[model samples]
Target: MGLQVNIIKKLPGFELRVDFKADNDILGFLGASGSGKSMTLSCIAGIVTPDSGKIILNGRVLFDSENKINIPVRERKVGFLFQNYALFPNMTVEQNIGFGLLKSISKVERIDKIKKKILDLQLNGMEKRYPYQLSGGQQQRVALARALVVDPEILLLDEPFSALDEHLRNSMILQLKDDLMGFKGTSIFVTHNMEEAYQLCNNIIIIAGGSIDAIGFKDAIFNSPPTLCAAKLTGCKNISKAKKIESNIIEAIDWGCKITFNYEVEDSIADIGIRAHYLEIMVDDEDVNTFNCWVVFTSETLFRTKVYLKFSEPIGDEKDFDILWDTSKEEWDLVKDKPLPLKIRINPEKVIQINRN
Candidate 1:
């Protein structure tokens, strides 16, 4: 079954306006902190009330402001996995998983249900363990099992791996994806991370300034962002104020360079965005769209080096560069000893036109 939400929430200093539908897909809410990501989930789960909105899940009216129908949280049939996992420290894993079952269930039936979930989630040996005794991943699985045992019509997760370490976060993402695959209802995953959202969600909704800036398939939103906020949220590192120079050319005000595109430049395009990994290293600066750049500095990750570059001509910030080029660590090692004035190029087809909308 699908879920539909069109809601407006008014907080002290922030207002959230979002409207979207999920056709039983893993819908991702991608936004920075305090961007109303968690609040939206709360509203849908009946944990928080919206000032005015309508929420229908699996053809049931969970909330409707005009109709004055606000279903109770327990009756909404929505499963919520909190950021902290929120496992019961006093209760054992088996008790936690079975806690959501209906009160009318027989004791023996409940025990069998919990045992099946323990086997499915691979928590059999740790059934009697307390929350503190389990690892972060195991705790997460217990929380997930607890949420799913109720057979909710929709599942809402708010940064489920926020507390895990880096290695655990990676593995937990894979686990979460696999676990969600078995869920037959609509699932919503909220996070500030673009990579994690793209990896776990088939459809993504970019939240900005308390509103949905963009919503579509994961690839479409990443490939062509409609607004500047959408571009930045999707991990586009290089976005510049653009001035249309000609039908096929536009000047990137922040990068201090003119780029000639193969396609006609639309007037509604107010900015341009380029993914860091899409940039290319150039042998010389004479090629089209190629420019001489000063390698300001570099930051290293586990296997990649993010190079900060500035144009030879100062048009943007003098102290901070506006362009970033991500290269492999092996490639950076070969050029770390080289001199300044490193050349780089931007492919015209790879450039994303950010519209005013």
Candidate 2:
């Protein structure tokens, strides 16, 4: 089955207006904090009421503001995995998982479901332990088991791995990916981590300022973000104000550079974006779109080096308008002993045209 959401809710500083549809594939809501990603999920789960619009899951109406029909939270049949894995502190793992089924199921059936869930989630031995007594990974598994045991029609994960350490988070993501293979219902994953969204989601909805900035498949959205906010959210490091100079040319004002495109340049393009990795070191100054930049600073990460460079010409009074260039350690090592002033070329095909009005 699938999900259809078109809702509006008013918040203190912003108004949440989202409209999207997704099938059984995992959909990721990618946005920064205070972007109303969690609020959208809450509205679908019936945890919060929306000011207007509709929510339909598998042809079943969950909320409809016009009809004044809002399903109760318990009756929505949605599996919500909170960020903190909200498990009852006093209950055991088995009790927590079977808690949702106790009302409508017999003791034998409830025990069978709990046993199957524990086996499915690989929590067989720690069935009697409480949430505080288990490790982060184990606790996450228990939360997933509890959510799935009720046979919910949809699953909503709100930064499910945010509470875990890096090592545990990676391991649990692998485990969760495996577990999701057998889930028959639609799943919505909410997170600000671009890498996580790229790895797990088939479709992505980017939220910015309490609205959907862009929505598309994972590869398309990452390769060509439609807006300035989308580009920044998708990890584009270099963005500048652009003015269309010709049918296939645009002047990047902030970087003091003019870029020519092989494709048709739209008149509505207001910004230009280039990924850090897409820029290459130029061997000669005659190359197209190549400019000499002053090296401002350099930093190292686990596997790559980040070089920050400033344009030769300053734009207005902003002297710190720098472009970030990312290169592999091996590549950087080859150019590490090179001279101070470096010339870099921006790949024309890698240049992203953004329309953010």
Candidate 3:
């Protein structure tokens, strides 16, 4: 079964208008802060109401404005894991997990259900601990246990891993992935982290300016972003204004260079994007897009070295535009002793054409 959403809601300064559908696979809502990713999840979970449109899950109508149907939050059968875990401070882990179960169920049955959840989340001995007494990972597991105990039709996560430190975040991510494997419901993960989205989601929806910019399988969207915003959000560092000059050539006005594309150049292409890692240091000017550049700045991390460079040939009266290039530490070591006035090659095949409209 799949989830379908086509909704609109107006806020004081922003309006959210999104429409997409997802199957039982994990779907990601990838966006920047305040871009409506969490709001979309809230609408799905019945935490927030859309001014208009419909939401359907597995053929069940969750919200329909025209038909005047709005399911109550409790009856929606959707589980939500908030950014802060949202666990009761005073409640024991056992009581928190069993909170959603019906009161009519016998005490023994409820205890059995809670026991199973504790075992599944590896929270067996911590069942009586309070939220504050447990570690970050344990608290997260308790939240997940609470959400999953009721067997929701849809699971919604809003920046669920944002509060953890690096080590704990990675560990919890793996644990969450394992726990989600046996889940029989559609899962929606909302996040601004590109790496997390790519790692956890089977499909991704890129939201920008309170609207969906693009939605597709993870690899397709990352490899070939359809819009300039999409490219930026996906971490494309080198982008320039482009104008089509010929069937296979486009001039990047900002970079003061012309790119020859093997694919047909579209008139609608308003920009060109190139990933930082795609720019290769030129040992010799043998490539078609090879150009002379000056190193403006350099920075290095443990794994990779970052170089910022500007085109040697400046555009008329305009400030020089810089482009970022990243090389692995291994590659950087070989060229660390290279002379000044660096020359770089732009891989024509790796260049991405973007249509802003």
Candidate 4:
């Protein structure tokens, strides 16, 4: 079964127009805050009504604008896992899971089915526990079990692991990935984390300014984003303006010198963006595009080290650039305060030069 969304809505000072399709794959909606990612999910879940268009799930028309066909949320057979876990506090875990099955099956049958689901989610012994009794990870698992207990046709998870600690979040993400194995139905997962989006979804859709900026396979969308905004959204920290010098060469004038890259720019306005990981820190040598840069500052992160550098001379009124390096603690310490000129390797394709109008 697949999910299709062709919808339009006009919000205060913003218009959301989204069109996408997904098969049984886990599709991720990636966008920054206020970019309408959450709003799109709400519309699909029937929580927000769209001004126009249709939503179809598994051949069932859930919302059709022309015919005024809109299904109630209860009848949609969609399992929505909210960001807050949203477990009913008054009811025990078992009761909350079995709540939806009451009308479909007898008490005994519902209890038995819920018990199986609890075991499936590894929450068997937590049956009588309240929401307050479980840890964040356990509570999230219970929430998933509760959603699956109803045997919903599709699963919609909205920032499912945002509330957990780092360790717990990673563990829960792995668990969720495992749980999706037997789920043949489609899933729409919403998140702002680029790593999470890349790790979880087969197809990634990025939204910006209430519209789709880019959408494709995880690698394609991140590695070759369609616009400067898309590159920035996908964790590109080093972006510079460039002008075409020849057919297959573009010169970045702002990066200390006229660094010619092995890329063609047909558009008059072109911007090149490179991820920090792609940058290097070493002495400037005979490398084709090498330039002199001085280390101005350095900082360390959990997994990588970052160093900010400034150019020897101003170029196009731009004074400096920052280059981040991902290295071990020992490696970072060796160059902690050293003044060095670095040669950075550039992959022509990875260095995205966006054509702006």
Per residue, candidate 1 scores C-alpha lDDT tens digits across 78-119 of 888999988878999999998878899899989888888888
Question: Where in model 2 is the C-alpha error above 4 Å?
Answer: 313-321
What are the lDDT scores of the predictions, listed in order? 0.90, 0.90, 0.89, 0.81
Tens-place lDDT per residue, model 2, 1-357, is 599999999988799999999899899999999999999999999999999999999999999999999999889899989999899999999999988774867889889999999999999999999998999999999999999998999999999989989898888889999999999999999999998899889999999888998999999999999888889999999999998989988999898888877877889889888999998897787976888887767899999999888877445554474699999999989877788568889888999888746
lDDT, candidate 4, 1-357, per-residue tens: 599899999989999999998898799989898898889888988999999999999999999999999998878888888899889999999988877664857878887889898988899789899999999998898888877887888888999988888898888888999998878888889999888888889999999989998889988888788788778888998888878777767777666445555554575658887787766555556676655666555678886677666665335645355554455667667766655555555556557767875
Candidate 3, 46-165: lDDT as tens digits: 889999999999999999999999999888998889999999998999999988887788989898889999999999889778998999999999999999988899999999999999
Clashes of each: 0, 0, 0, 1
CA RMSD, predictions in order: 2.0, 2.1, 2.2, 2.8
Evaluated at residue 170, the lDDT of candidate 2 is 87
Question: The CA-based lDDT of model 3 is what?
Answer: 0.89
Pick out the ten consecutive residues of candidate 2 with the lowest summed lDDT: 313-322
